[model samples]
Target: MDLRSHSKPIEEFNFLDPAVLDNPFEYYRAAQEQAPVYLMPETGMYLVSRYEDLRQVLLDTETFSNNLDGYGMLQGENWKVHQGILQERGWPDLPTLNFTDPPVHTRYRRIADSIFNAKRIAAISDRIEELCNLIIDRFIDRGECEFVSEFSFPFVGTIISEQLGLDSEKMSTFKKWGEAIMAPTSRVMTVEELRENAETIVEMQHFIAGKLEERRKEPRNDLISALVSSRGSDGEELDMMELQSFMRQFLSGTYESVVTMISHGMLILLREPGVMEQVATDLSRVPDFVEEALRFDTAVPGLARLVTRDTELAGVHLPAGSIVMTRYAAANRDPAKFDRPDKFDIDRKDKAHLSFGTGPHLCVGRLLARRELVIAFRTLLTRLKDIELARPLPEIAHVPHALLRPMKELPIRFAKADAA
Candidate 1:
């Protein structure tokens, strides 16, 4: 592949373009090779591509802020549009975990920390394994299946919905709602897209608020009840709005990313002949393979932060309120950080990938996501024999988004294995 053909002059580069979304590493490499830090002409935001620069920015929260107001997607006219739309309807802003910094972030993170604690992660291990088998069972006899929509999407979406005490039967709708709510925050959306997303968010919020009220009236052994009944350090229960905000964060965090991780991991293995066989032969390596897949092609490739004060990083002076975008995909593949950066090797000792992000904003659902992938792959390899792509490999493309990179479809065929 001639990388130069894909390269655009720094002034013309736009990560949201369809070509870049197809292979962002091309632009990431161009940016890194040209300069570690360069101002993006499309949004007037600085792009940080080097691993060290990105790591320092992520850790230096004092200088780099995660306030939603400064998020790259919400910057420029997007924020004004969003605020105006919400103000028109008199809606309250639902402060999400990803959009907040420490102290406040600490408080919100604590509210949901118990739900993803060691005990909870361990307790759900078996459930994850069971769900993997059940999901496979649905399409096993079909001989061929669309892995993304039919398998990965529903598998992770249903688990998240179930965890939130939502109707599992509505998993498809939940997937749609998740997409809508995340659109404006994750990428550049058209005015129509923004309006549709706002409407979907309002509908989802009403649903969550109703659930909160139900849990308040008659508590049950579910996440909504758990959250409603949860007491803070001050021994006060979380209010309805807080619960709604947390629920939005929970849904956004897990829904698309989990499915993307699973589908991408599998796609990586399948694309590389014999790698799948190597992992399938020794299932213990599945976890390491998953990590490498994350490095090679992360789900959430980049995130944005606001420059909080006059600061100089990598010799580039940045003023307060400037938006900085950290490219995790670029960082993960930085040759300065990883040897043979583009190669996927499970045996590599250096596994410090930025796929789950870093510093205070590391994904809270990291453990659950990893466990789901490992269990899903383990179950898949055990029950499906001689698995191979049901369609031409080149035909497989990713859903175009500014943040997420998930397979559009993965039609796979396999022979059902005998009872183990």
Candidate 2:
């Protein structure tokens, strides 16, 4: 596919435009070729679009700090107002896993890493497969279902919710909390919306605080229990505010990205001829398909990094204290890195996409997310056959947000495969 011809100049491109957000490849291609470190005129933030450039930014943690001082989303006037609201009515919004630099981040990460270690992931594998089959069983016989709401949402939400010892029946409520937590970073909201989301987040924090206290008293075989009981390298347990902040990240980071991955992966299967058949025929290929799906349409396209000092990336100079948005989706499709980057070729040998990020701040839940996708698609292809889009491509809509590319719905029609 030719990604060369953009109608407008790079400087004229507005990252906040909903149209651009919906379909950003053309703009991404232009920026990659013309200005790899393009500055957004509106936000004064530098957008690093090249794969190597983004990788460099991620590795050089000293230069590109993750802590945005609660400025990751709300900026200037909005940020001041947001801080006031949280301080007065709710817990002070503090940086945890994805928002902090080393030393401090290391303390939090060490605890999180132990909880989501290889053993834990392996132990949960059987349960993941079982959940996949159970979720599939609900809509497989119907021959038609909204993939996002019916499958991806509940499947991922239940697993994460259960791990956190939350009520699975209240997945919808959890989703709202996640969205509210992410709203400030994803898009510019009105003051009213910000206040409302702030209230919801405070509610979520209180709810988590209550859970933490319960776990402290009577530890259960759940993540909340583990977190409450776990200690850092210094043998210091996380305080109440720290625990609340960590849970906030866990809730926001774990859910939507996986849901988007599953839904988008299904969309790819329906769009690409014979790919589904290939995966169904040989289950081993599901992993490759998942990797390509992640590369082709990265769920969390980019994340904000605070520039700690003056730096030059891809020939563009960045000043200290500036916000740099690493465009992982664009970097994943960089022609310099992946040949035919725009095409979704599962057979391609290179699978080093920035979908889960890299370096110190790499996604903590990547293993779990990958396991969920593998089990989900593997079971989905095994049980459901002849999957096709129920509606036309244009009819399917994505939620309008700057940071995430979550599909509003994925209506699909399929027939149940004969039991083996």
Candidate 3:
């Protein structure tokens, strides 16, 4: 049960360490057993590792706020400098959906929920499968390809871009913009890096703003148009700042997490014996496999929540203004909540993993994400045969970031199903 028994003291464990970032499961296991709510000596942030504790924090948003303004890396002089850059070149930052607390958050969430409704997602099912097939067709003949770049990034980028009424051919540009927008939260950046990222973000803001104007003038059946036309409970439409914020969140949230999820799911199939074949033979099993992949190696390891009021979690006192990171990666593997928590069992009955989070702030685009994943794997398995890694597992590295777990590349070999 003791995963990292030989590791250093819990107090000395640095969550930001490269080695820890690469493989934090053992540390997570140790944290759950030793200190469910361990305070990181490096950042003074509390790491909430237990499943029940994270669930409690997520449910009680009043005590633990989602607002990151003047918190974590966004605090002090750095934040001011970053905000200055945005103000000078683009729309000033605003807390819209993911960054706002209830009452205010409710308005944005309602609009978002309406846009990403079940009907819209169901309607896109065929399009998702079509995109998957088209992407797979490009490399299927080669018998070897880099899955991350060749499949995952383009597939996700094109979908989100097209949904925003953008040119799918500019998916690479969109991908760059999305990464720039997410840089600050993903990891600590130098002043120079922050400014560079800010400039790119401003570019994106202006681009999306132009699109919003087009939608306002002549609305279309696209997400941007939905954001422009839809009214909140107050019957007020979202302003420019609010529209830009939603686009920013959507671009960053959708592209990276879903892309990583798809990549990780494929890696699992390649590693696990007989699992790929089983799912490939019966396409219905792909959904279960997708859920298990999410639980086993979630794209987003954790997210920060600012403590609004002094509170206690897992019996540990968390003072007001403290940052509590809901360790979704750790909680998903908690043995107390999941049997054989570390094992990648697709048939596992418990599906309560907090990968997309829980409560009101749950990811609005989860339905689209799940649909994309299912269609993606189903298409890949159907089109390719004998899928296996082209390089050793140790050679594949993950891009180091504080929030997301994304693999750099996944080189693999496969045979065209028809040719086979």
Candidate 4:
């Protein structure tokens, strides 16, 4: 394959560039047009954009390893400091279910499935709905709210914290620790930023380690106890390091993507005229609308995989150890896969999207996420009357990152409901 025909000059593409981060579809369109697979020399990443190609890569996990070098949570410079701190404390490298390949991945998945199964989720549906209403009650009377900080973060954060058997006071601390741990993966940071992030990483790890010991001594019904006591098919429990690894992945996965989906999904309804009113009038369409919102704008845009062996993908030859990025956001909007790809149509016959990914490494918490979104919108529609944007669309903005596109704030107004 002639590389010249597929992509413009290398100078034309820089994913980290602010312009690209703001709107990546144009770049995805160009890449898919020229070459479904294009090598980004600056970042040493082979970006796979088209729907079919990305889908193939996701399914062909044998060729692509989940554990990509220099791409995990513990990647880059600052993490080295974090690694040293962990080693000094005798903690092993925290590799989670998402960061491993087969056998190990299989075992971890089974363990995770036991807890995040249909039975467990269905049992909690009422509690989740009750929690949603409780959260809304705090702000519903005000007739105005900053949805992200006031509701999205704390609402989801508190639930996840409770599941993990953490103290109520630890909710805010989790966000700080999450930012500190994930910031390094998104971009280059200053020395001060790196140091601060490393320090927080140590703090969070210490806290979790203590909880692990507590669960070991006196098991409870929460996820922490499950991690401490749950046995694999072989009837063996994960060691402390393994347990911590699962905790990191579970906590991060639970809070970040779910919050992004909920907050951004609402933002989409606000931007698309009449959509909110449509859902408000007819509650049945809420699920479809949420699905469309996820497809239209995925929270986690893409994920990285390391090429395990010399291989060819979409006409591009990739050497072993190459970093390949599967762009789920781009794949979700591929014209070949969906008609009028850019348009947000809830009634589209084919609603299958890669927002939660595909194949073996697909997000384990997807069911929980979908349920949360549905209940959130349902409760809002029932509790608040005549919902509308509190501020102009232009004022609403997003914070860009390499891994995600999250709204910065979402201000909205609505009338409170009568006491039931």
Worst 10 residues of 4 by lDDT: 1-10
3 or 4, greater by TM-score: 3
In Å, residue 381's CA in model 4 sits off its true spot by 1.3
Question: What C-alpha RMSD separates each model from the true structure?
Answer: 2.6, 1.7, 1.9, 3.6
Instruction: Write model 1 residue lDDT over 150-230, tens digit each, in one string.
Output: 889888977887778788898767987888766765566666666666677777777887777887899875566778888
What is the TM-score of each predicted model, taking all chains together?
0.92, 0.96, 0.96, 0.92
Better of 1 and 3 by lDDT: 3
Candidate 3: 10-residue stretch with minimal lDDT:
68-77
Pairs in clash, predicted candidate 4: none
Indicate the residue-level lDDT of 2 in model 1.
Answer: 46
Instruction: Please give the TM-score that candidate 1 achieves against the real structure.
Output: 0.92
lDDT (Cα, tens digit) per residue for candidate 3, span 1-420? 346355456766678887788788888987987899999887688999999999999988899888776222644477677788889989888888877889888888999999999998898788878888888888888999999999999999888988897789987788889888777776667788877878888888888888889889999877878889989898888888888878888887899999999999998999885899889888899999999999999999998898999888878999999999889999999989998888889899998899999998899999999999998998888888899999875532787777888888899998878743
What is the lDDT of every predicted structure here?
0.79, 0.86, 0.86, 0.79
In candidate 1, where is summed lDDT lowest over 10 consecutive residues?
Answer: 68-77
The list of candidate 2 runs beyond 4 A from truth reads 4-8, 70-72, 394-396
Report the C-alpha lDDT of model 4 over 69-122, residue by residue, as the tens digit.
Answer: 333342565556656656776464556587778877898899998888777778
lDDT of each residue in 1-420, candidate 2, tens digit only: 578554367877788877788888888998888888988887778889999999999998999998875433654476666667778867787777867899889888998998888888888889888888888888877899989999999999999988998988997798898788777877667777777877887788788888899999999877889899998888889888788888888888889889999998998899895888899999999999999999999999888888999988887888998989899999999999999998889899999999999999989999999999999999998898988989875542677676788888888998889889
